[model samples]
Target: MWILISFWVIALAAVIATIKYRKPLLLTVPFFAMLGFLVVQIAMVPMPFWETVRFVFSLR
Candidate 1:
């Protein structure tokens, strides 16, 4: 999907910008936050995707 592609492009841009200019908190913080989110998701590897979605949503 184009949306997915664009999302990745934006994420890549953030990473590149962070690398090029290490002084921007706006770019660096979100990049690390997203990376942390992915790490947590990876830790949930044993759960099914639907169950993970349900469990996470149920918390809020």
Candidate 2:
């Protein structure tokens, strides 16, 4: 669960940094990878999007 959250945070940071710096194109790789993984994870969730998000954040 935490790994999933971390993936999102890392992907977001990578995207922002990549945009601001415009040097490290490598960041796009992880951004796309995490985007794919996130889509799969969201698809697998039995509940709705908001509920799944709430559940993920609710973890200790």
Candidate 3:
């Protein structure tokens, strides 16, 4: 999805910037990348509890 692509683009840009700037913050790139993944997952999928409740209620 577009959201995932944009998140990766921004993350890549941040990594490039960190490299060019030679800042210590570059060390956190992995964490930021993981956080981006988490954001995408949260955006794309329903939470397990919500899905379970939806299915349970729909069965009536």
Please, what are the lDDT tens digits per residue for candidate 2 over residues 18-59?
889886884877767777877779769999988887888799
Q: Candidate 2 overall Cα lDDT vs. reference?
A: 0.80
**lDDT of model 1, residue 47:** 85
- Root-mean-square deviation of every model: 8.9, 7.5, 7.4
In candidate 1 the C-alpha lDDT for residue 20 amounts to: 89
lDDT of 3 by residue, 1-60 (tens): 886687677778777888899886875776677777765655566667567556656995
Off by over 4 Å in 1: 28-60
| Local error of candidate 3 at residue 44 (angstroms) | 13
Stretches off by above 4 angstroms in model 2 are 1-23
TM-score against truth, every candidate: 0.41, 0.47, 0.42
Each candidate's clash count: 0, 0, 0
Judge candidate 3 at residue 16 and give its lDDT.
89
Q: Give the TM-score of candidate 2.
A: 0.47
Ordered list by TM-score, greatest first: 2, 3, 1
Cα lDDT tens digits, model 1, 1-60, are: 874576577677877887887756646655665677676775677888777767767895
lDDT of 1 at 56: 67
Tell me which residue pairs clash in candidate 3. Answer: none
